[model samples]
Target chain A: MARKTTQTRKAVVTIAAWLIGIVIFFPILWTILMSFKSEGDAIKAPLAMLSSPWTLESYGEVQARSNYALHFWNSVVLSLGSTLLALLIAIPAAWAMAFVPGKRTKDLLMWMLSTKMMPAVGVLVPMYLMFRDLGLLDSRIGLVGVLTLINLPIVIWMLYTYFKEIPGEILEASRMDGASLRSEILYVLTPMAVPGIASTMLLNIILAWNEAFWTLQLTTSKAAPLTQFIASYSSPEGLFYAKLSAASTMAIAPILILGWFSQKQLVRGLTFGAVK
Target chain B: MATEHSRTAARLMVSPAVILLFLWMIVPLGMTIYFSFLRYNLLNPGMETFAGFDNYYYFLTNAAFWDALINTVTLVVGVLVITVFGGIALALLLDQPFWGQGIVRVLVIAPFFVMPTVSALVWKNMFMNPVNGVFAHIAKSLGLQPFDFLSQAPLASIILIVAWSWLPFATLILLTALQSLDREQQEAAEMDGASVLARFWYLTVPHLTRSITVVVLIQTIFLLSVFAEILVTTNGGPGTASTNIPYLVYAQSLLNFDVGGGSAGGIVAVILANIVAFFLMRMIGKNLDA
Candidate 1:
């Protein structure tokens, strides 16, 4: 009886998981389907929509009209550029906070995270005016600066958590072997923490890449990322459902691929400190 | 002596990030506080004057302020409840051995990576449209009238979208936590004649307390400032049905150009968030110290 009950329970779980997973993923699948349809057929009955012949007209039109190359380039540059800059700054900070026992280290970390909690709109106006005055509006450099600052806390926090997990004895041994501080960090500590660093970089890139609030507010034509690219399709010239879906598919396709490939690392990085 | 010198070096290495973040926080916050005390509007250009608490008074007393405040609280609490409960159920399901487990996990987490704006647009067009949406089609097939999700139930719709986006986060955390549970404890419970529900309540829920706390705190921080979802779906309303504090601040400043009043509202939002953060920090502090 117990074995039978357990088998039944397992079957129930299997069916429920599949159902929920498909439902959760339906929108992305639907959008991809719509991207391949003609505009008229894209909005038809669901059965008819699927039955319609697939076409690449929407992709071709999106590429021609919207400067897809520029938006794609901006996205790559902004996401990667901000992640690298943030790491360059965050690693040393996290290293210190992790290794060096200071009375204020935990306080400093909490303060940084608290600043992150403060509503971003509180500072949006001032940041806007500052960027305007500095001629950084609609500039990639300005966005890199903003993204780096905004994401610094997460990078530092994640790295700090990772750094703590790695026993200090390893670094202490490196120092005993006559390694200078630079070589100690560059050679020994960094190599040992490569997985952590890699995951942090990957996660930060995803966050900065998908971040829409600041990206939309701070950028327009000159430096807009794919989020802005998707936004433009919202008010199209006509009922261009297919074209809009194509733009969205193009915009999300790269990140989705990256996410799929690195999902394990992404999941690990997110839940690293939380689960423990 | 060398240790002391390295400590100094460590401080130097960390200072650049510290200083940059300090500037990032203080300059804008200082400006906001200063602006809240003055009569300022970009439109008027040069007629700035000291208004003291007038801007604060106007913002504090506005009906939109309360509406946005209530909406903000509702969205945060609503999304938290759905994600936490749904996440627990999904995590439990995924914890059991199953075929295609990897595929199911990937599909479950896919929505989290979709850009929030694209998700909102897809929901608005394909699922929630009054005339031709899937929900409408289903209702028609079943001989029931479909209600406008984004119109009649704007706040509820926004909450649903936000909850969907965050459910994976909760699930992932709980799933990880579940994986690390002591198998011995479960086996021991079974040997003692405990039923499934009893074992879950007695053994599993207590083990998941830390993860549950982390999910709630982190999701609350992001959800309280939810803007993009509301912006793309309902534009904060058919009225102010879905305007949260962030949207309210945007309408006040950019739409109305009331910089002074907007800053005042911004200050209030910061204070309100700090209250929430206070409890969260205490929780984190206790959890970490444990």
Candidate 2:
């Protein structure tokens, strides 16, 4: 009797869960569907819109109208460049803090995390003036630099948590076997840290890719990322739902795939490993 | 692990990150403080005279400042309330025994990854636009008027859109927290014939308290600085109806060219965020010790 009741309950739960899930995901699914429709049909009643004939005109027009390739390249450069630069700076710092105990390590980690909380507007005036004077405005290098700085603490924190979980004895064992300092890290620690590093990389890429605040404020035409490019459609251009959907679909698709895979790391990273 | 040579090496390795972060924090912050007291404007760039407290006085006294403050708080609290409650409900359902759970979970969590510009723009144009949006079509089919969401209830509309983007985040974190619960305890309670509501209220809710607090704290940090949504949707329109401190600061400094006033507003925003940051740091700090 208990087994039969549980089976019924499970069936009921499945339908309810799927229903809610589709409802929550409907906007995105709608956008994708509308991307394939003409402007007139795209904005029609929901059932009519879904049943309309599909076309590739909007996608083609989006590419022809805007420099979509340039923005795509800018996004790739900023997210990847910043994540790689952050990794280079963060690994050693995380290594030292993880293996070498210091009295101020915890406090230092907390202080760095606090910097992430500092409202960017608090310094927007100076940063803007600084960017203007340095001729860094709307330049990929400037965007990369700022993104790297903003995300550095998070990269370090994620690495430190991962490294801390590793036993120090292994590192010490490699050192005692006459391994040079460079080789110890290159061979011993690097292999063990790969998973953590990959997860950190994945999470940060999504973050950097979707980071709207700084990217929106800092860049204009020359170095505008996909975020800014999509935002440009918020004007009258966005009224053409088909083209808007096509552009948005392109901007968010790659990161959405990456974001799905990084769900586990995201929990660990964003919460500062508090929940985990 | 205690050799002086290695300790020196460690310091050398860590110094680059430390030095860079320090410079990043101090330089701009120092300049913002310095600028707050001067009569500065971008357009009238010249030798600036000092104006102690006037920028603060004007910014503090302005009607728009108060409205922005209220709107900012409303935006934060409104989104928090919706997401936290909705997240708990969704998390509970997702935790249940079900078929096709993986696909449903993926579908539910998809929005968090959509870039803000895309989500805000899509919601504004595709879902909420009165003339041709889906909602209008729905209303018209029912023989009702097409309602203009952004203009009529700009702040509330933003709150809904922002909440949609954030619900996945809250659900994922809370679900992760839920999965860590000891099933043996739950089964034992079930054997004791505890009612479902009683079980949830007494056992599950208590267990989720820490995770919920973490969600609230983290979400508060991001919500306070919501910019792109407003920039895209309303541009803080209908006469400062949706303008938050971030938007106001951008307007003053960039649009109005009043650097000193903008700096003052920026400092106030920092102070407001720091108050929340203090509590959040304490919470995480305790977790680290545990």
Candidate 3:
């Protein structure tokens, strides 16, 4: 009888959790749903809105109205480009700090993290002026450089955390086996930290992809990513409800899919030290 | 043995990124400091002189500074409270064995992956619009009045969107922490005839305290810099209702083009952000070391 009651209680909690989770997720789901509806049907009452016959008209219209492919490409280049650059730079820095102990290692890491805390807007003027003066504005290379720098600390921190989990004895063994420093890290440490690195890559991509401030302010036309694509739907005249939702849905779809596939790694990377 | 040559190589490998960031930090900061002491504006080009703390004095005594300070604090605190509490509740619920658990977890985390601008736009248009939004439809169906979420309570609405976006982050962290708790302790507590509330308060909450702190610290860092949401939704209006320090600085520089005043405001923002960062860095540093 007690076991049965416990089972029932568990069932109730599970049901409630599912209900709340679905409710929380409804907005995103609803936007995707609305993206399939015609403009008139999108603003219809909720009851009819959900049950309305879906169409691809909004997607077609959104494509016709905006350069979806360009935005998609810019997002791809900026996010992947910045993430790759950051990892290349961060791996070495993290390797030094993680494997090679020095007095200022912790202080260096702290300083990098502190740099992240400085509000980006605080330096917007200088960055904008610098970019303009240097003719780097609205360029993919410029955004890549800035994005990589901003996310460098996070990338290093994550890689450093993953590197710490590795036993020093393993590296000691590799070194004793005549592995050079380059091969030691490239062959041994890199392979071992794949999961951590993969998750960090995924997380950094999401961050850079979703990054709105620099991307919005720095780029006007040439290199504006999907964040700009979504923002374009907003105007002083009025909000474009249906088209905006469509843009938002399009902007987030790829990352949402990516996040779903990498949930395990993300969860683990996030909980790296919380349990300990 | 790790040789001196290897250490030098390591430093060389990291030098490009380090030097870039160093310049990135110094150049802007030096400029802001310089501009803070000078009389400069975009409109009054080439007519400049060192004003010696005049900009600082003006900014400090201004009411906009205090308003932005309050809004920034309130937004951060409000979002933290909601996410932390809401996250704990959801995390506990998710910890229970459930059918389609993976699917539910994905759904819970989906909002976090949405771009802030997109999420804000989603909330602004489809969810919170007074006439045609889903919330209005529901209110009307239930025989209630429609509400203008953005206009009536702009700051609160923005806070809700932010809290919603961050809920999954907190929940995932807390859930991971919760799962790490020893099952034996919970069983023992239950076998001792402790009520559910006592078991939760004593066992689960204690286990989650560290995760809570981590979540609070990380989220505080991100939340303190919240800009995209406010920019997308209300543009920091209904008369500065949703304006945070970042928006305030943006307005001062980009809109007003009062370079000296704006740079001084920028320094003020830096000081404000560091106050939180100092403590957060300490905790994060401790966590990293451990």
Top of the candidates by DockQ:
2
**Pairs of residues at least 3 apart in sequence or in different chains that clash in candidate 3:** none
Candidate 1 — which residues are off by over 4 angstroms? A1-9, A174-183, A236-239, A261-272
| Index of the highest-TM-score prediction | 2
Where is the poorest 10-residue window by lDDT in model 2 chain B?
B281-290
Candidate 3 Cα misplacement greater than 4 A, ranges: A175-186, A236-238, A267-276
**DockQ of candidate 3 compared with the true complex:** 0.65
Q: Over the stretch B177-224, how does candidate 3's per-residue lDDT look in tens digits? A: 888899999899999999999999999888888789888877887888
Model 2, span B226-286: residue lDDT tens: 9999999999998999999999999999899899999999999999999999999999988
- Each predicted complex: what DockQ? 0.63, 0.82, 0.65
Q: Write the per-residue lDDT of candidate 3 for residues A44-136, one digit (tens) a residue.
A: 998788788978777777778777778889999999999999998888787778877677778887887778888887787778778888999
Residue A97's lDDT within candidate 1 is 81
Candidate 1 C-alpha lDDT tens digits along A177-238 = 99997898789887878988888898888898899888888888989988877776555353
Give the higher-TM-score candidate: 2 or 3.
2
lDDT of candidate 2 over A1-276, digit per residue (tens): 999999999999999999999999999998998899997888788899888899989999888988798999999999999999999999999988888868888898899899999998999999999999999989999999999999999999999999998888987898789999899888998899999999999999999999998898889889999999999988784468899999889888998899889888999999998977
Give stretches of model 2 more than 4 Å off: A175-180
TM-score of 2: 0.98
